[model samples]
Target: MNIVAVTSCPTGIAHTYMAAEALEQAARDAGHALSVETQGAAGAEPLDPAVIAAADAVIFAADVEVRDRERFAGKPTVTAPVKRAIQDAAGLVAEAVRAAEERSDTAPAPSGETAPLDTAPAPATKVTEGAGLGARLRQWLMTGVSYMIPFVAAGGILIALAFMLGGAEVAAKVNGGTFQGRTYEEITDLSALVEQAGYAGVLFKIGAIAFSMLVPILSGFIAYAMADRPGIAPGVVGGLLADAIGAGFLGGLVTGLAAGALVMAISRVKVPRALAGIMPVVVIPLVSCLVIGALVIIVIGQPIASAQQAMTDWLDGLKGANALLLGALLGLMMAFDMGGPVNKVAYTFGLAGLAAGNLTVMAAVMAAGMTPPIALALATVLRPKLFTPAERKAGEAAWLLGASFITEGAIPFAAADPLRVIPSLMAGSAVTGALSMQFAATSRAPHGGIWVIGLIGKPGLYVVALLAGIAVSAACVIAAKHVGRAVPAAASGAAAAEAPAPSERAATVA
Candidate 1:
């Protein structure tokens, strides 16, 4: 039977695609013709509308509401949560088809003068809560984070630039101060010193100010994504509450979603007919903000500030050879897990240090972070014989991603052999970290490679630092690969099995 499906989840990241895959596979396994559209962070891209129109039935597996419901109005439509699509997709599809058929049979034939389907209220969508509240909340938070990335990058670089400018003009200010018989004149007159100092101070401050509200904005958007226009007010209010309560970005995200949920839930409680729409949009958001804000400011804010400060202080105090060691360790952590929390923590710490005039630390961190992927990439390119056909191909592709400093470029390799591979990665990153520190390398840009010279300090040393790290990582990876076979798949067998069944067979071939 011809079938169309749409899959979505609150996060619009991993799960959305996962659900679609499960449904598609189920359809194939059951020998039904199928096409699926995914509504995700990138937005909806359903199978061709014509296909959907011609299909015998449509299935919607979503947590967040899917738009364009009018298109499937008269078609037999099966509605389900993303989880059901994943957990028991075949059964769910059958049930959905049955439901659709029943609806189709019961509805009266279209009259000569038909009412437009578009004018009718859409069918109710479904959500799966199987992932637990925390998981769901975290996904909602990511929506905000995804939106906030550009703003942070823009604001951060501009502020960093301001610092560079100030550093160049410090000498003049100091000279003027000295000429006026002020000892501070010298400090102000050294442009390089002033600019550096300013970068560490005023420029950073500006960036911080610009980014301070980032979490709240992110939280608000996540709510918006979920509830559409109705989610806006509660999301904003919840974000503010998170900030007040000592909630960091994560907290803001949670509060924003919580606020949206609260508003939505409150809206469901009976209200005067005229006030129904306004209740959620205005009254609920307002009440949520007041409650959340008061609790956050009074209880949460100080702890969060103290925690952030402590983290900053720890990085600030990192010095000499140890600084390199610390950076190396962090870099290894980043590459080992791709973009997991461990990686994010290391990256966040490195960037935070950029505002403290400790660019060397950051330089080591960045160099080490990208070394594993890049090194492996190079190894694959230079000695194709060293890897399996699949591995070599992957390595070759990883090169471009590595060049752009995507640590996860090596994830496929690591996942295959965590025990052996992770150690190799650490060794390589440590070497890079140590060398960068030894060379006193400094960087201005939080990320970027050779092309970012104008944005970094001690470009020559930075290049050397990176080269050293890459060389070390490459050597380690190559040596390990020659000595070690592809990682034992015992641990990952179940995971690999979960890939499309065809993929499991491919793994066997490899």
Candidate 2:
């Protein structure tokens, strides 16, 4: 089989290349001709048109939207997340091959004026029959998140800068009335300090505007993922209504799904050839927006808003042990699978809360997420004799990885010694989470690990919480290693040859 594939992730870092490498190796082993394009932070290498034309099928293993997707418009395509390709490259390739065969079987018969086999490609139709409901839903959610992340990152970083440069009162200055009814422009002329504060106020206002659009963008893209272009308008409109009604992120999710489902249903309706061209441009967006807008505004809006408010009040009211318990649970989930679905779920929960201006949960999550790699790195240093040479090298890399908030850096250690390492990691992460919550730390940014510490509400306590977790987990790992049989350096090196590289198995978080 001839196959062409593209792999991308939101961060366009490790997972993109990992998936590409995995697919290439799998294709070679399976005796298939393959070309893969990796879309990474650095950019992409365009696939040769000849190769794409010759390919029997296309695979998209991406967590973000594929660039120039129309290039594959007439091909049978299989889509999955980049992690899926890394974990099951061979399986995915095999599925793509099967999809190609199905596309061939379903192709329209050749007309009287026949063309050569190579010249006549099958009509473009995505092959999603193999994707289960859960997979599809996950893909939709991830698509939304991938699109929404930039807004959050930009808004958060800018807000953090405002707090740092303009002091905490910058928001008040931007609002005008709180600064003795003086406009920001007038305040800037008052004094040097006031001028600096005015600049900060500008940053705050811009960031707040971006932050305000986060939910609506998330909703729009999620609908686009499910029903393509036609779903976007309705989804955005519905999301705006969700916000107006105080439904929050929860409301955005509801509207996104509802809009996507409505668009899909509408797309299935038969239309005359003359009207078909205008359907997507006019009928679908108009009818779907009206239906979704009305449903969210009149029927479900108040109930969802009330529920959201109740949840917000509960989170805000959590104190002492109750907050600590919730934090610990979040930490455990984040550490349980490194960058897997469990970790994503925990992270997503934090993001949702952050969108609602509940920063404590995000702070706890980030703290917990940073613990595993750092703790393992500390353990490797504390007891070098217990670790193999390869483990020690990986540990060295983990220092930077952990500090950068890439939890997958600890994955190699955990994969090698799951029984002992996992429990230690969970223990450390939970401790960090609890401490962060107890300290009432808050974070505006969704990512950037230790690099964003300056943005933390209480940087001092956050550091203490992080260090405490690292120390506890490091101690626990050291003790566990003392009880277990340690592999000698030479034997461990020989064993490493038989297994996949640790980097290959490590998942990426964005």
Q: Assess every candidate by TM-score.
A: 0.42, 0.45
The TM-score of predicted model 2 comes to 0.45
Model 2 lDDT, full chain set: 0.69
Write out the backbone clash pairs for model 2.
none
Cα lDDT of model 1 by residue, 1-510, tens digit: 787888887678877788889888988888888788888987777578789768776777776656665566545556555776888789866755564454355443232111111111121101111222332333344345444544445444444354345442222242332211223434433346436345444453455455556666766756654454456666776676665554545466566666667656665577787986577457876776676566566566676667656655565466433655676666665565554444555667766666566677667777777677778778767665554333454576555445545454565455334455677877777777777767777776565444355656777776776677777777777677656333211112111111112222221111
After superposition, candidate 1 runs with Cα above 4 Å error: 2-146, 149-214, 237-252, 270-278, 312-324, 329-435, 442-461, 464-510
Clashes of each: 26, 0
What CA RMSD would you report for each candidate? 15.8, 16.2
What range of 10 consecutive residues in model 1 has the weakest lDDT sum? 112-121
